[model samples]
Target: MGARCSKFSLCWWPSHIRSNRHDSSDVDEKDSLPGFIEYSLDQLRAATSGFSPDSIVSEHGEKAPNVVYRGKLEDDRWVAVKRFNKLAWPDSRQFLEEAQAVGQLRHMRLANLIGCCCQGEERLLVAEFMPNETLSKHLFHWENQPMKWAMRLRVALYLAQALEYCSSKGRVLYHDLNAYRILFDQDANPRLSCFGLMKNSRDGKSYSTNLAFTPPEYLRTGRVTAESVVYSFGTLLLDLLSGKHIPPSHALDLIKSKNFLMLMDSCLEGHFSNDDGTDLVRLASRCLQYEPRERPNAKSLVTALAPLQKETGAPSYVLMSIPQVSSSSKQTVPLTPLGEASYRRDLTAIHEILEKVGYKDDEGVANELSFQMWTNQLQETLNSKKQGDAAFRAKDLSTAIDCYTQFIDGGTMISPTVYARRCLCYLMNEMPQEALGDAMQAQSVSPDWPTAFYLQAAALFSLGMDDDARESLTDGASMEAKKHRN
Candidate 1:
């Protein structure tokens, strides 16, 4: 269970544009919040391919209490879906109310809440998807070079602006604020996740990280104040400076000892001036003060960091080396017949091809059992295959998957075709991750099989890994050409 915020006043627009008088231009109450949508469960399911495991983008994966999934809308707009656990927000009405409050907020510095769903016992929130991933991934466990000093400073400033905006909108508290809560948009600019603006549960447990990272006041009061958010922001500042999670106390000690240079990330060397480094360190120390009242507000934070910002003219994507693309842009790639079918997810075409191929390539792969006592086991395994094939032909995908599972578990036969068929079944059922596993299994059973690669491309396409899908499609075409020449 997590924390829940108190109900607050709602205004659709910023304070500057807010109007107290009703106008004829307001066509509908729902339309008042321009981009906010109340999505149906079925719509979300289709978007994320029935919430496939491969769609999960949260830091903790499926194991997280509330899982975040990357999904594309019917309009092809990418989104992040946060599915809260059953215990979170037991009262559906309260969940909707909170979602509405957060949904009204739209800020470039924030990963704005796009919509929410409250069907039955399920509680979910949807927001604009940030494709570049989270600060935790880039700062703490980056695969490429560590985040640049310019980008780091930009992230801090953007986050502060997000907080200030939320505060102005009367949504002040942010639960479990951490590196994971800061996401990089498609343009590589950092935006604070709106998910943190909503509470995880009603249990008064505001923080979810290690106790060391939790604000000391929260440890004692079991609550989070607006000031508590500033403390977490301090921790984030420390993360940017050190590229590590240094406990607040440890960070403050180093700051007090005049060990500011030691507190900075070694990777940041030659990238920032000593003065800039000292300024950020000093700001972090002020935010980490023992007295909550002494901490700076979000506005002050923005003011302090504004002058320290570097590379003011450069776009974030350039600094991060993330490819920039227009929203309407599409990748152009030549595809083979099967590859084209996969790209379009044309199940009818895919089915016809699989039916034509049948199990010709899998013949004689099964080992014959020498013992007569195991004869019944072999018969059962063969029976499962027959049932699976029959179900697959009839397009009873669930039944086909069950029968295929039984055959795979039997271990008496090795049929690449069975894996390929099951892979198609999983795809038709909108379970791309499972389909991917089956496709990989098919490849291991018969490495040169073009069908396996084609199936892989289909699953990858469904999961929105377009670049990988293109490569797989090319491989499948190459293998098909080699087979034709043979």
Candidate 2:
């Protein structure tokens, strides 16, 4: 099974040095964590005239991401107040933690974290309001009015520098580095914001995510190393260059073909000069390197982005560059009817949320459509695979993984099947570092699948752990008759 499974994108059991990059710790608690803007819910109400809709400076229509409030701080500086409605409460603690961190770490490129209000089950974060909105707005907001590459480069520099500051402060992880999180200043400099999910290790595991901005390691393991952040930075660069959310495709293959220049954002078609675009692309590629150790840190990122700043005077945005391959390669994946049920169930949950939000409003429809389009795209990808293969295919690793997740999530998948499918996904997703997670997950649900150990060993090897993989492979080799049967 191990020999059959190895591929260009083999799962490697990765290194383990957990950093609760995005989760909060209780060592200091809310009290010891200083720098509170110290205002009651009532004061906040007065600032924004009782959270009036008219006070809203900007709302993009997403029911959850929407920030509703208009307010003035006591010092007379205008501010934008973002309040978390009941729907976002589950992620609210993140907001409070960020409010504390960013509020204290002041910089010209950063918004003044005025303070926050956590009261009566209400959550609100206050920051100096930038009237201009996010950098993403000007770049991809409209194809006709794309931002000049110069501006994006400047934004990248600003982001890198800000992250450098955060990273230097002993240890702090700015978890969300997407375009939406970057608010622009009057002069067009970008300040990282929306940091409710920033990770600062104190005690216990405190962060979890599968955001595209994140590295596969964090998705598989609940930890944040600076290298993972660099990986995310690369993706952001790609977005900046492309002015679109480029999906995970065969990027590594593109780079290998030396045609990575073609992957430049369509908006920069004519603007890219010889050897110029290549500079930024190279920077992006470096950040996207699979091995976290191989990637640069924010400090190095600052150096990488500096050239563009010198060339253009402003920063250019880059989309998150990734090793451009589908999460699947030539690795076998098993499909079971149980996985289909979980997928349907996950869809139902999404649909139910839409219903609760009364998806009749234009914004609601837009957000729902965006989400459905994503799901539809996934379905189309899966359908394309199912049409070609029946039981298992080496190339269907990621697709099968998704299929199985849907099944398991739907609560219909049996024990061994769940592990079997998950093992495939974890391996292909470049998370060999976490095959054992599913081992535990599967073991909790059911036991007696020796195949898991074999799969785990492969995952371990992918991360360059030959000894572990060899040991597990020996245990999981199964009988020669069972193998030759294939």
Candidate 3:
């Protein structure tokens, strides 16, 4: 008997699977993608701690058809370990094929597959764990403040781009798409789950999917096509518009009557302009059209929502930091320096916020720091930067790294020059991974700086990504040339 047919009823024996990163170039073109890892059963069991109950993450708890567990690999990376029901994937090879196909999909808006384990009858998939949780949690059952209007618009664009990317890759049939499948990454950006593609092949029954969110065609025909995915995307748009889960038919009625105000989430009362609201509502209305052929494709949807993206350069966390409306009134609560730092991740913004709302004592006194203490800390950060600059000039790589790291960790106002200088330090220290992270962060803070790209190329080259490094170097050179030309 094959591993898939091994005797195990209902429950899958927890496998101890070891994860190994597989290079794309080494993969047989017919089998798997570059990053796909096939873990040993031992590693999987160890990572999930014998698949403990604590690992289960689904709202249905452990009672759901398939259970998802949060696990940590030996590399210290967090991942979601989803163990599928035996019946769902009776053929292990089929599951692997589909998984490998989805694994090849790489998009900023999509959660890429990390690895999988297939030992005996156990069929498990591992994916990057999103720290910010799901869209459904933030929308209907918000714990913190409501998601901002700008953030919602950004989410819409992101989801659209994800679908567009998947469809372009020929993985057209996305079964039972919903907000729950969309997770928020570390930066508060939305990432569509790769598991969304690995669901049971189109059958009449839609298991565990919210009926209200399901497209009418799926309910009637018991099949999913490319067009059917559009219908599901339309429902997701409706969810963004109304925080509550309103059925497509009912939402259509609200749209037809031009009672969009009633359809809009009460928490988003003043944040959005009427025109923007109307535009999104109109787009949703088109998406919810009964006939699959009548619904717009993901490409068109992206095009339509492109204009609604107001803050293209704003970090996702910063967008979410905007004060949320409640009871038809907008509120602006001043944030603490650390709170601002946590959201904006921009040193300049953090410093400005700190200055505007200076350090406070227990009684909320302004300028809590005495002159000497404040000056000492500020001078320390500046001195570190200056030392780092001096060391870099002298090619003292180790000293440059130490000073740059101190300056960055000191939490002073962020300077692009300092980050660029530190990134070079990291590269020279033979820490390409750290160098890449700093280079990317620098780009995030000062997007147009070609020096960031130049550093990124060096880091990539050091990391053994020759082609990618060359591309980055080319981009940096071109940007620098353009800048000089102007």
Best-to-worst order by lDDT is: 1, 3, 2
Per-residue lDDT over 156-189 for candidate 1, one digit per residue giving the tens place of the 0 to 100 score: 8888888887887787899989998998875678
TM-score of each: 0.63, 0.51, 0.59
- Name the better of 1 and 3 by lDDT: 1
| C-alpha lDDT values of all predictions | 0.78, 0.53, 0.66
Order of models, best TM-score first: 1, 3, 2
Ten-residue region with minimum lDDT total, candidate 3 = 1-10
Off by over 4 Å in 3: 1-34, 59-64, 199-210, 321-486
Question: lDDT by residue for model 3 over 1-486, one digit each (tens)?
Answer: 011111112111112211211111122222322488888778977877788886667734333457788766776556788886655667878878887777777666777787888888778888877756689987887644788888888888888878887777787777668888999765567878988787563222443456766777778887788787888787788888888878888899888998999889889888889999999999998888888889899888888988787666666756654211111111111222233232223333322432343212112212244576577797887799788867876768789788978976876546656665666666656677887788777666666555556566566666877545545544454454345335
**Which candidate tops lDDT?**
1
| lDDT of prediction 2 | 0.53
Clash pairs detected, candidate 1: 2-201
lDDT of 3: 0.66
